[model samples]
Structure formats: structure tokens, C-alpha cells
Target: MILKTYRWSFVVTAVGLVLAAWYGLSAHLGIGQAIALVLILSILEISLSFDNAVVNATILERMSDFWRKIFLSVGIIVAVFGMRLIFPIVLVCVTAGLSPAEVIRLALAGGDPETPGTYGYELHEAHPTIAAFGGMFLLMLFLNFIFGEKEHHWIGPLERLLEKVGKLEYVQVIVAGAVLLIVAESFATEHGRTVLASGLAGIVTYLLVNGLGELFNVEEHLEHGEHHEEGAPARSNGPTPVARATGKAAFFLFLYLEVLDASFSFDGVIGAFAITSDPVIIAIGLGVGAMYIRSMTVHLVEEGTLAQYPYLENGALWAIGALAAILLISIEIEIPEVVTGLIGLAFIVASLISSIRYNRAHPEEAHAETAAAHS
Candidate 1:
């Protein structure tokens, strides 16, 4: 079962390690050294992105089979080439006011991040804006999940308060805006305008992508007349079959996933520089890690793990909220990547423990959940 689920991830890990070895030998680094560095970074990426897999599975399970195939194909391409390699180069071009060709040339020159007027240097200089955009977007997503309608609560007291606040008009938006305003004025005083603008862009991107996805989903659902009975009145409160979306609605959901991936990539892309300035090695290591995350997402969906552990998604969202705060705070604090990953992992572990206890206490409910998932 594990092999069937993670075949591609294993293949990519092997290929990535081989390429890393080749690159290391060519650079005069021993094969062993090269493979070791790649292995270390790959582990780092997996640890950092494990929470991402859980969050991704929440959406991936709702997509149709064809769309899942598209996710494996097109999604991998974007995750590897787009965010891992090309995005950093493009970011340098924009931040350094250089042409794409110039940026590529700089990168080819072995742009050590410590050196000014180089690819890595330019990219690092753009970190503030990157953090602001990614942080706000993730914050919005976390807020939406916790605040939106839900029968389950991972942390009853806190989640209940958020849910009640969610019933108020645009509370998430208001809170997000307030956060942006405060951060822009206080911590990012020098680049306040840029920080605010980037944060606003993040918020707008979330609103546009999530709103459109939900809108198209409603349209697709109504068009199918999914719950309407023959010669019978339509029911307004029928079960929502959001998990069966396809066509344009599914396309939008796929787009949302890509954006979320991009936001999560910021830390990984930048943090890799702390180890090595070689973009190729970073791409190979992180790309392999991305495959593992994708595979984990598929495994979770196929195993019906979320159905069994109802609090898992809530935990992932809480972790996301923590990450968003860490990203924003790191604009001035320089928090370590490992620290970020550990914080998220702590939340996930707590939630898993909570879920197991819930299941033990409510055996009947757990059995009902298992039956529904299988059905």
C-alpha cells in the first residue's frame, strides 16, 4: 500500500540524490559530501512541509480523479520549476531592477548569497515583501477555516469564540487588515508602504481565489441539480457534496492550491541559502521534498485518515496561523526555519493526541464516522 501510494515520490528522491551527487562531484565536492548535504536539506524540507501536506489533503480529497491526475502532473511541474527555481530568479529581477536575462546571468555566475549584486543577495533583499505576502495570505486562510461554519472543534473554547466572531460581518477581513496596519506601522517602519501593499495583495489574492472557487462551486452544484428530486420540491439544507467538484470549479480549487504552495515556498527557498547558495542543489533537494509532501497528501486522502481524526485539519490550520505569525515576525526577528517547523509540528502532535482521546471517549461516533467514510 505504501509503495502504491508513494511510488513517484520514491522515484524522484532517487533521481534527485543522483543529480545532487553529480553536481557535487562536478563542483569538486566529494560525492559523499554532495549526497549528505542533499539528504540533510531534503529532511529539513519534509519536516517543514509536513503540515502543508495535511492542509493540502483537505482540499485534494474534494477534487475528482481527473483533477488529481492533473495535480500530480501539472502541479508537480509548478511546484518544482516554478516556485523552487524560477520564482526566486523572477523575484530578483523585480527587486534588483534587472532584466530576467541579467538575473539568470548572475545566477549562472554562482551568486553567493553573502555577496552583493548577486542572485541570492537580490532575492534575500526581497524577503520583507515575500514574508508579508505569504504571511498575510496564510493568515487569511487560517482565519477562514477556524471562523467558518463547522460542527467540530479541536480546541473547544478557542474555536468556539472564533466561530462566534466569524458570524459577524467580515470579521476575518477586519482582523487581517488590523494586523497588516499594525505591522506596517511598527516593525516595518522603514518599508511600511511596501509591507502594507504586499500584505494587501496577499489578502486580495486569497479573497479573489477562494471567493471565485466557492462561487464556481455553487454554480456547478446548482447546474447539476444534485439534490433535487423528480417532481419534488428542492431542498435548501441537503448535504453539501463539495467533495465531488469538477470542471471549472475544480480548476479554481487547483489554482488555489498552487497559490498556497507558492506562499509556503518562500521560507524554504530563502532558508536554503543559509546552507548553500547553489540554486540547482536547493531545487533538487526541495523538489524531492515536494514530492514526498504530495505523496503524503494522497496517502492521507486514500487512507481516510482525516475522517478518522477529525481534529487533524483544525490542527493544521492552527499551525498555519502560527506560521503566518512567525513569518511576519521574522521580518525583523530572523527566526530559524527549524524553529518554525517545530512550532507547527507541536500543534499537529497536540491535535493528534486530542483526536485519539476523542475517539476513545466516543466510540459510537467514531464508528459512525468510519462507516460514513467507507460508504
Candidate 2:
């Protein structure tokens, strides 16, 4: 049912574009050219986001159905609008003192080589800043993977404390309120919005990203070493399914995935300034890319791909952390999107292939090896 729904939606989007192309065709614009532009952009976004989906699947597999549903819906909204649309405008407004409208104009000017800069700054000049953002975002993702608490070990007092706080219904709400207040305050202070935006961005990113993780229960996979067993496997006559996360666990897991997704998208949006700035074009391009990434994630999860390639999942987590670090650093220096994306994709692909080879070489020991790693 879900697959059918997704396919139907995809078809509808495609058909709508076709019809719209006819109108553009009538306006002296070549229909083929417009369609090609959309297709090319879509593919670029999807290819760049493959690593994101690989990482996302590792997180989503730990989520319950309820939260997964929310992720597919609300999460996309945040990705397309909050991160891609609103974020760039906010950045431009803070750094350049340009209104969103002016920023949009600058973005449109991106295609005209005659214009010296987009919104008064060359993309090459901005590359360092973008790189810094991607680097910081990626670094954090890598740390979470390498330094994450092992599962066999007790979470001790710290986990218990956070768990207690997490149990409170009002805690996230309070945090959310604080974030909004800071955003407002930053907007009001002259010349301080940049710093304010950075701080607020971190806080919001942390809340939503971590919130999703907690909701989806992916943290469970990270907290427990791969070797630890909570209990004996259930004995079933039929094929057994991977354990599904539920309730609070699922919600948090979903939240974490979304947060990570947002972090991953930071550089892409900033890089997109090099493309057309028609807010509509930018939104459509990035939004389509986000859709494809989500679809890819769901496909991986449903197919039990992560269970098949455990190490790939590990690599993906590290990549996510790395990307997070990249985002934080981008606030200071721009990084080339191509380099940032290629590095992440390389790690995931390498890990996945290694896992495949390892599993093939030691079929009988696969489960044992996986369980041991958990511990």
C-alpha cells in the first residue's frame, strides 16, 4: 500500500511537470530543455544525497511505524522549506543585510556570467565558507560513530539523567520555546544576527536532530555495542522480521533522522545559490532531491539492507557525524560540495562492499560476528 501510494505521487508529479512544460513551450521556451533541466537537477540532487539516504536508513530502521509516517511527511516539509528555502534567506539576511527578496534576485543572477557575483559575492569566494559548514557537520557525524557509547556498557548516571529529562513532556517544548526566543532576539540585534543565527541554528539543529533520533530509537543500536543481546531471539516458524522500534523510542528516532537530514542538506542549499535563484526553481530542485533521498531511505529499510551490510550502517553513521561537523564549520568557511559529497559516498561504498565480502567469506559466523560487535 505504501509503495503504491508513493508511486502514484511520483507519477502525478511527473505528469504535472509535463503539462507545465507545455505552457513553458508556448512561451518560446523549449519544452525539451525545461524538462531536461528538471531531470538533470533531480538526478544531481539524488546522487549527492545518496550518502544521506544510506545514513538515514540506518536511523529509520530503528523507528516505529508511527514516527516513520511523521518523518515521511513533516520531515520533508522541514527539509524543503525550513532548510532549503528559509535557511538560505536567513543566512543572506544576516550576513549581507539583504532581504529575502533581494537574495532571491541575486540567486536568479547566478546564471548570468556577465554579472560579477550572485548577491554581491562570487560562489568561489563563498566556497570556503560552504566547505567549513560541510566539514563541521561531517566531523560531528564521524565523532558520534567513533566515540558513541558502547551498548554492553551501562549508560550509567548520565543516561539515566537524560532519560529522566526526556520523559518529561514539557522538556522538548521548553527547549523549542527557548530556541524561538533566541531566533527572535537575534533578528532584533543589529549586526548580531549572524552570531545569533549560528547559535540558534545549532540549538534548533540539536533539538530536532537529536529529538528525531530519540523518537526513532536508532540510538538503541548505537548505545548497545553490536555484541550485546537484550534477550534471546523469538522462535517463529515463519521468516522473522527485524525488530521494530516503538512509542517514544520511535518518535525520537524519527526526529534524529530528520535532524541529521537537515544537517546533511546545509551545504547543498548553500551550493544551490550557484544555480538559479528563482525561489521556485531552487525549492523545486532541492525539494525533488529531498523526496528522492527519502524514497531511497525507505527502500533500504524495507529491504533489510542494513541488516545485510552492518558495517555500511556503521560507516554511514560516521559520515553523518562528519557532515554535521561540516555544517558547523560552513558558518565560517565554504567547502566545495563536490568534494564533501564524494568523500561521504566513498566511505559508505567502501564499508558496504567490505561488509558484503566479509559476510560471503564467513557465512556461518555472520550472526555471531554481528552480535559480538553489538556487545
Candidate 3:
């Protein structure tokens, strides 16, 4: 079953490694050096993006098979080529006042800071705005998740406190905005206005995507109506919106995932340049890593991993919150990639351990769940 789920990832890995090796030889960087760089970048991307896969699985479970396929297929193309490659070029072009052709030419020139037209340098220079936008968007995601109603709490005291605060409407927005203001004030000596505007845009983008999705979702619509079928016995107020939404609701969800992906990719895309300036190599390596992540998401959904390990989603969100903080803090102080990766991994690992203990202590619940699955 695992093999069937991840066959595509395996194929992409083989092809990407071959491409990495061949390009290293062609670029005269030596095959060994080329493979090493690609491998390092890929590992870094995967390490930094495990939380992304968890969050993605949660959303993907709410979508139908068709949208899920679209996400894995069309979405992957947009993620690998669009978000990682093309969008960076577009951003550089807009920032540098150059055309797409000129941007691509510079990218091919590689990553020298002294060079007039180094692609990596231009992209690296644009990091602050990228950080502000992506950071704010991801921060909102984490805020909304923790603030909204949840039956389980991963970090009892802190989560409970946040939940109490969440009872006030739009508290997530207020907190996120406050964080943005603080970040902007500290980085005021830098691109203050640009960062503020970019951060605001991120918040608005989230509101539109999330708001529109919820508005169109059948679950929400039914919940609002308080209607019941005439011939039916009494039922719960409404069904939970999971893996059953369709039509316009799913479309907004699709858009949300793409934006969410772009937010997650900001760090990886920038960090990849520190390893190698060759955009082609970065594309192949990160692209392959992305394939594996998509596969991992599907595996989690099909195996019902999130349902089994209930706190995992909360852990992933907390990791996202930490990353958001790091991204915002990075504007004033340079942060290491290792710090971000370690923080996220720690949350996920702790959550996994907690889940295991929870299951063991409640053997009856676990056995009942297992029996229901078999039935």
C-alpha cells in the first residue's frame, strides 16, 4: 500500500538525482559536488517543510478526489515551477524594473554578489518583502487554527488561554496585526513601508480565501439554516466539513492551498540559494522534495494518521507559528535555517509521543476505533 501511494515520488527522485548528476558534469562542477549540493538542498527543504505536509494533509482531506488530484498534479506544477521558479523571477523583475527575459538571463548567470546581473543576488535582496508577506499569511493560519473551536488541546495551559482570548470575535486578526506592527516598528530603519504593506496584503489574502471558502461550504450553509429533512429522525445540527465539500467551496480551497504553499516555499526558495546559485539545480532538487511531500500528505490522509494521532495537527500549527515568528524576527536579525528546522521538528516529535501515550492510556478507545475500522 505504501509503495502504491508513493510510486510517483520514487520515480521523481530517480529522475531528479540523475538530472542533478548530469548537470553537475555539464556545468563542470563535477558530478560528486553537484549531487552533494542537490542532496543537501533537498534535505533542507524536506526538513523545513514537514509541517507543510501535515497542514496540507488536513486541508486535502476536506477536498474531493478530483480536487486532490488537481492539487497533486496541477498544484505541484504551480508549486515547483510557478512558486519556486517563475514567481521568483517575476518578483525580481518587478523589483529590479527588468523584463522576464532579462530576469531569466540573470538567473542563468548564477549567484555572485559582485556581479551586476546575478539572479540569486537579486532574489536574495528581495527577501524582506517576501518574508513579511509569507510570514504574515502563515501567522494568520496558525492563529486561526488555535483560536477557533477545538476539542483537543496539545499544550493544555497555553492553548486554553488562547482559546479564552479567541472567544472575542476576530481576535486572530487583532493579534496578527499587532505582531505585524511590532515587527515593522523594529525594522523601521529598513524597508518599513514596503514590509507593512506586504504584511497587510497577506492578512487580506487570508481573509478572502478563508472567508470565501467557509461561506460556500455546504456544512456552513446547512449549519446556518437549522433545517432538518421532513421524513428523517432527529440528527446533529450539522455534519463536520471534512472530505465532502464540492463545487465552489472546493475551488476556493484550491486557491487557499496554492497561496499557503507559496507562503511555505518562501523560506526554502531563499535558503536554496545559500547552497547553490544554479536555479536549474535548485528546481530539480526542491521539485523532487516537493513530490515526496505531496506523497506524504496523501499517505497521511489514506492511513488516517491525523485521526489516530489527534494532536499532530495542533503541533504542526504551532510549528508554523514558530516559523512565522522566525520569519518576522529575521527582518531585524539574521536567523539560521537550523533553528527553524529544529523548532518545527521538536513540536512534531513531541506531539507524536503525546499521541502514543494517549492511545496507550485509553486502550478501550483505541480498541474501539480499531474494531470500527475493521468493521
Compared with the true structure, all predictions reach lDDT values of 0.85, 0.57, 0.83
Instruction: Put down candidate 1 lDDT per residue, 111-160, tens digits, no spaces.
Output: 77879887788888899899999999999998888777665688899888
Give residue 313's lDDT in candidate 1 (0 to 100): 81
Best by lDDT: 1
lDDT of 2 by residue, 222-271 (tens): 55433235664421111123456666666666656766676667666656
Q: What is the full ranking by TM-score, best candidate first?
A: 1, 3, 2
Please report the candidate that would top TM-score against the real structure. 1
lDDT for position 359 in model 3: 83
Residue runs of model 2 more than 4 Å from their true location after superposition: 1-9, 12-16, 19-29, 104-138, 149-204, 207-249, 275-278, 321-336, 365-375
TM-scores for all candidates? 0.94, 0.66, 0.92
lDDT of 3 at 24: 86
Q: What is the lDDT of candidate 1?
A: 0.85
